[model samples]
Target: MSRAKRKIEHIHHALEHDRDYYNHFDDIDIVHQSLAKLNFDELSLSVEAGELKLSSPLFINAMTGGGGERTEQINGEIALAASETGIGMAVGSQMSALKDPAERNSYEIVRKNNPDGIIFANVGSEASVSQANEAIEMIEADGLQIHVNTLQELIMPEGDRNFKTRMENIQRIVEGVSQPVIVKEVGFGMSKESVECLWNLGVRYVDIGGRGGTNFSKVENLRREKPFSSFENWGIPTPISVLEAKSIHKDLHIIASGGIRHGVDGVKAMVLGGEAFGMAGTLLRVLLQDGRQALISEVEHILHEVKMALMLMNARSTKELHRQPYVLSGKTREWQEQRM
Candidate 1:
């Protein structure tokens, strides 16, 4: 199948797949403070991920583009919601556009719709320095995300087999690109060792795209003639990935994603050291099912929920959430103890 055809299939499978599977965020609980005094009106939802600043900590994560007109419409609607809510948005991989100029408009619609919003251009880890620059310039993106998805590629029917130069490619892009470079996972989470490697290669922003949200393994397996069911439950959970990334470096900015469902989950991620929260499957489901206005309302509602969570924790801002107390239990605690 062609890349564009595969893009639509991925979207369909992602929306149809059951995301109710345990993501381990439930294993975390932020201790509420009653004696502490803080006003909700004074709380700030602003966050800084590397050099890119976002009005709200929650942003529309990479979802779709470069499939065709359908994807262009999808990206346009998502861009509109991101613009209306004043949050950052990342387009799906621009490799298809780079390979075929006709697909360029599908990704370009994102920048056209949200001219002033913080936009991020995404590419696979295998992307070259030139491809990365073209992706960033195509969207006029504030930053660029070089996503690492070994598991997804293995499961993908037509995915790349050779992965030897991914790290080298990422290093070249980081050194070659002027925009902020974010090395992210494609839902299968990152380990402390992986985070350290990226940091050593001059990468400061890491999106621990943890498990429990959109299982690209499952998505790709659905497209395969013989599915690899065992790998579907693979990879670290989002909360655990955040802990792992934080355990590596104090200065490494972490964006907690994969399986992030709501505002409460976002707050839990923040308390665990996620500089920003990214929601892709959930936001895409909202947009495809309920339409653009509904998606915008859902984004607003999530922002509201984040504030409410902060207020309940007696935290004045996103930064203060880190100072607040939190408890980890179950598999998440076990992972934290074993890993950290």
Candidate 2:
């Protein structure tokens, strides 16, 4: 199939399957403050990711582009939602757009709608400096996300098996681009070693698109000529991945993505040290299944929930949520104990 057609299929599959595959394993907790001494209206939600300042701590993450009319419509709707809500957004892998310059318009529609919003252009980690630059230029992105997905490639029939030069390639991109480079996991999650490597390479931002979310392996498994059981469940869990990344580079900005749902989950992510959160599957479902108004309502609902969570925690702002005392338990606690 052509890259563009594949792009739309991927988005549809992600929206349909993410809830079943990703949301089953984890839960987020919020510590309520009975003496919060503040009203919900007093809560502050503004936070910054790199040079981009956001009205809320959430962003519609990288999903799809470079397909045909349907793909353009999907991107346009997502962009419209982001623009209407005043949130940041990341377009899906621009490799297809890079391959066919004509497909660039599909991705560009995001910025065309969200003129004042923070737009993040994306490409695979395998992309060269020139390709990365062109992607940023095409979207006029405020930042760039280079997604690493060795697992997805392994399961993909057309996957790139040889990723030996990814580190060097990422380093070059970080050095070559003026924009802040966000090192993101395309669902396999980031290990401490990988986080250190990216930090050393000057990646000040990282997105732990951890395991407990979309199983790219499962996504690819469906397309396999012959089914493979080994690729079904792979990679680190969300909370554990965050702990690992924070241990190595405490100062690096981290955005938690995979499997995150609702306001309390967003609160737990911040308490666990994630500066921002990205929601794709849940938001995309509302967009694809219910249309743009539904997606906007869902986002607004989450924002209100997040603000209420902050008020309950007595957090005056996003930064305070990071420092608010909390503890991890269950599988997450056990994972951290073993890792630490």
Candidate 3:
């Protein structure tokens, strides 16, 4: 299958089957503050990712590219939202455009719409350093994201299975690229050991694409000709990944993803040491179901909720939220205890 066809299939599969993988691990909770003196208007949300200074510590996350006209439309809307809100955005894997130059417009639409906003180009870890460089140039990205998805690749019918040379590719890309290289997981969260490895390799930003949001494994299973139940529920949970990755590398930039829903969840992620947050499944649902205006309303609602949480915590900014103490309990606590 071609990249464009695969892109469409992936998006449709994600919309249909991603929700089943959302494990309702309710034991993770953020204690509410009732006696707070801060107001919502005083909350600050600016943060730096690589060379770009995001108005808010939030990104739309990588969604899709190379699909065709529909992919262009979706990316255009997302870019408009990012530009309007002053937040950064990431484009999905650009391998399609790299392989077939005709698909370039699907990814370029993002830059066309949000010409000044920080946009990151995404590619898989298996991609060669040359391919990675091409992907960045293809999108004229502010930064580059290399996604690691061992589980998804194993389940994906057309996915690459060789993982032994990934580090070599990462090292080459890190050394070869002029822009900052961000190593991210697809849905399976990055372990502390893995985080340390990337840090050692001079990679700065780490996106814990934890399993609570869109389960790429599950999504792949749904798309597979013969689904495998054994690999369906594989990966680190979102809260646990954030906690573990932070414990290993406190100074590194960690973007919390996977199952991030409302403002309170975003607050919990920040308190747990995430520098920023990624919202994909929720935003995609709104975009596909109700179009651009509905998606805009959803983004505004989440931002308001985030501001409210910050105010309650007396956190005047995203940086302040990181300093405030919060306890992890239930499943997240158990996972941390065992891993730590």
Please report, in order, the local distance difference test score of every candidate based on alpha carbons: 0.90, 0.83, 0.83
Looking at model 1, the pairs that clash are 213-259
Instruction: Please write out the lDDT profile of model 1 over residues 16-44, one tens digit for every residue.
Output: 88774566988987887777587778899
Candidate 3 lDDT, tens digit per residue, 77-188? Answer: 9999888777789999888888888888999999999988889999888788889888888778989999988888888888888889999889889899998888899888
How far in Å is the alpha carbon of 9 misplaced in model 2? 2.4
The regions of model 2 sitting more than 4 angstroms off are 18-28
TM-score of each: 0.98, 0.96, 0.95
List RMSD in Å for every model shown: 1.0, 1.6, 1.7
Best by lDDT: 1
Candidate 2 C-alpha lDDT tens digits along 1-340: 7787677667766655644343423544555678868867767899975675878898899888888778788899999999998888999899988989889888989988888888999999999999999999998998999999888888778889998899999999999999988989977788898898888888899999987666777777777788675866778877677878888866799888887777677778878888899988778877888999999999999988888888877889888987787766677777777887
Pull out the clashing pairs in model 3. 213-258, 213-259
Give the range where candidate 1 is weakest over 10 consecutive residues by summed lDDT. Answer: 17-26
